[model samples]
Target chain A: MEWFGANSFNFEFVSSVLQINNIQKSYGSVRALNGVSLQVPEGSVYGILGPNGSGKTTLLGILMSVLRAQHGSFDWFDGRYGDGYRKKIGCLLETPNFYQYLSGEENLRITVSISERGDEADIERVLKLVGLYERRKHRFATYSLGMKQRLAIGAALLGNPGVLVLDEPTNGLDPVGIAEIRDLIRSLRQAGHTIVIASHLLDEVEKVCTHVAILKKGNVLTDGPVTDVLMDEDVVELDATDREGLRSFLLTQSLTLETDKETGWIRLRFPKGQAKLEELNRTCMQQGIALTHLSLRRKKLETRFFELTND
Target chain B: MKIAPLLYTEWLKVRRYWAFWGIFALVLIAYPGISYLFYTGYQDIRSSNNKMDAMLKLMVGSPFGFPEVWHTLAYIASFLVFIPGVLVIMLITNEYQYRTQRQNILDGWKRDEFLWAKFWVVAALSILLTIVYALVVLVTGFVNPDMALAGIEVKSYYIGLFALITFNQLTIAFLFGFLLKRALLALGFFLFYFLIPENILIQLSRWRWHTGNWYHYLPMEASDRLIPPPPYLGEITNPADYKQMLQAIPEHILISVAYTGLFWLFCFWWLRRRDLT
Candidate 1:
């Protein structure tokens, strides 16, 4: 459901909420983040997608100031917010870190006091928002993994901050819990919060993220609008009686950016939304080639992620 | 940014924690109960025989009475300082075990703020335990059969010294917790260092050579020597040596204060530079 008004969609010139510049971090001999940089636009769901150990958490940790970077710097809200900038941003990094002995409500109270953003009254709103209102008085130790995660998100939402940084937010959630969190993130974005999510879940990122950065071994392989980074091109499977002729004719078309020969089919790629299967077939027929197989396949983010990291 | 909010935040974490209340309860019961036992034991020795009673009265004076009660209680209470030391270690290491230290910084606290928050907890707890020690002293002094309110003004400085010792010891405990980042490990190391190693070193230095006074300047040793034993033991043995040791109280206090400051400075520097995770 669209929680924000239509005017919120006007993105002609969106300012950046977080600007990371050339940050580098290392652990002994292993490099965790090597000169990584990105810009999270205001009121957008920015996703940092990568495989395990690809520095997704490291980069988020650096941005949140929990981990010190060996080199480079970052700015939140263009550094206009001063030292209290962190209070204006809600963050849940890595795991749900709360006092195990305290109840869910009590834990949020501590969070509110530390951030000094929301009052005790806001704690109930946040608990209800995360679906933990029913068990608000339950000790955090008694919470299931999903409940604990929900409480963490609830704590982050306590202040209604302008920016939210969530690292592997759906880590311990079940299917229903994951979907609920996904919707929560979408609704939060609709409410004008700029969310920066770090996740290896390609499907989740593709569904909710507006922008994405794919990382491989401490380096960002590609990043930008999701459509540009993950689905930059459309794929068409073309098989003809004469394979060489089909490949040769397809290469001459300006629409075809890449042509690959699979086992029994020829794969042709065109820029996103530039692929016209009927026109391609007609052009091939006009060249005296009758197509035996022709179909369009949308590039899945999972495939793109593997293709990027496998490099 | 202010210390009050940070302390309030820490109070929320421990207010419902059973371990915190458990240690506090132990102190309330044990501190006074142990002092009563010593008072009764001294009384029993004095009333046993006529000849021994005369000699004991000459040597012991009125230990549980007025001015001496404060010093006697401070020394006895120092032995139980490890109880609060254990609480400090548990509280700090629990943050590490749960990874809440990183969360605190992520929530809004600067690195130094987090360390300062913990230091405040250490200071607050020290002051609280010292208050309890003072209350026990007043009660013991008033209830003793040989109580005398005349010289009560003399040795009251022992209460302030007791507070300093508690603060220094707990600060050391905080350092151990920060370094180890594990509850069991920090507690184990603290107990080992406080109980076995430092004592062995101090005794070895004193008995094996003539340089025992040098070893009294160790972290816990300096604080322990602040109160020393009650005056009765000195009167029974070498009074001159005891007076000499008493003169060194200022040096021991300086060493204790320096160590406390050094530990906090080291923690602030280390925390600001190291990664929380």
Candidate 2:
């Protein structure tokens, strides 16, 4: 349950912030979502990861109640809030939707008024938080794509809602803007707000999300803590004059989970913290196969994602 | 939410929008401006020295005077309802254009709440139109030198009839904007329907098909009939025909109210059922 390592804060009791059940939707013969379900834990940054047309937006739309589900239901905060649950949840679905003629400050005012959560003072704080305080009076249509995206984040941050559901929060942002949003999300997590983000960027998800659900073709291929879903395994590569002998010898070892033969090396997979480079070198030499190359590397999430998606 | 906040939110949106203010300004000017022109033209005919002009004035009487001014202004102002009707369409379609309708629901508003807020706006605009009509009637009646205010109580209900006509027209515009979801398409189709199609259908029903009183019940036509053209013009040409037109004002009011309610209900149903995407 405690997926984060030593640096992570411990939650004495984890609760579900959002529980989605078998939500299905379609558009004129295209099945956008096929019974997709997932739960977002309280105080955790959850990522819904998928490629374009993989139903990430569709699922978020349904959960936000902007788009109706064909058959299924989702509960927020255990339905304790009734019809007022949305006020507790701030969401930015797909593109940054705002009145083009209204300034950023003016737009967030409407948002604040509708949510009935925050006030004019909170609006100032959020505008500054998203670094749009200076341009707050500028019309949304005049802002750059990055600025528009940031203003949207600023709007979502209003009222200081307990949960923030963002679709591609880092979209249209430059490298620095992306990093700033990541740090902001981390800071928000530290403040005990649960965040649900839908993104196709593996790097973004891997860096910021504690938990992720990988979706493909309207189906969830894998979902869990990032550490578990990515399969934390150490890969050891070995090359020897007698490749066949090294391969046979490594296949016999108990630490080797799987071995893959490459052009000039044999790749050995082992569970995390189980790869012993010195022992493998010594054993290979004793087996009369002198190793030419010996190295170890951890498997990347990108690799794991590709393996799961088979794309 | 409550009605005050709902209307306030709508005000926040349009307070800075020049298009909204521009259309509203046009309404304020044109509503009374056109009525004033008709009043002056009738005054000119009344003061003419020619025998025929004097005789014609006798037949028509003073349309700008007390009781007649209400009906006269209502008929003239109804022609300009399209000004505010365009405003309603633009406001509704702006949501679809910007996709803020979905964002409103996403932020916290129930789908019905968002729509009800707009319905209140329509109601407010209708009331404003009625007030303008009343002011025009009062100013025109009081300014006419030969007119007496004694008959002011007669046909005072035309003010409410004016409001119903505007409400029905605006609700129909709301339907167009909601269904089309695009400003140009909705406005174009609305104008085409209001200007040409509905008129043609009404004429065809009356002249070609000889459907008695059926044409009066058409959506916009029902409201149009609530305030028939200056009864004097009908009196001068055909007294019996014009007299027959006034008999159906009650029925026209009922049909107009029903159409307004039905249009609003249809919009509510569509908004609740269709995906805001």
Which candidate number has the best lDDT?
1
Per-residue lDDT of model 2, residues A148-264, tens digit only: 999888888777777889999988999999888888888878778799999877887788888989888888888878877876677787788877777777777654434453455
Model 1 error, position A92 (Å): 1.4
Look at candidate 2 and tell me the lDDT of residue B59. Answer: 76
Q: Chain B, TM-score, each prediction? A: 0.95, 0.95
Q: What is the fnat of model 1 with respect to the true interface contacts?
A: 0.88
Deviation from native of the Cα of residue A236 in model 2, angstroms: 6.2
Score candidate 1 by DockQ. 0.72
Clashing pairs in 2: none
Q: After superposition, how far is residue B46 of candidate 2 from its true place, in Å?
A: 2.4
Q: In model 1, what are the clashing residue pairs, if there are any?
A: none
Error of 2 at A99 (Å): 1.0
Give all candidates' CA lDDT scores.
0.85, 0.85
Q: Point to the candidate with the largest DockQ.
A: 1
**Candidate 2 versus the native: TM-score?**
0.90
Question: What i-RMS does every model get?
Answer: 0.9, 0.8
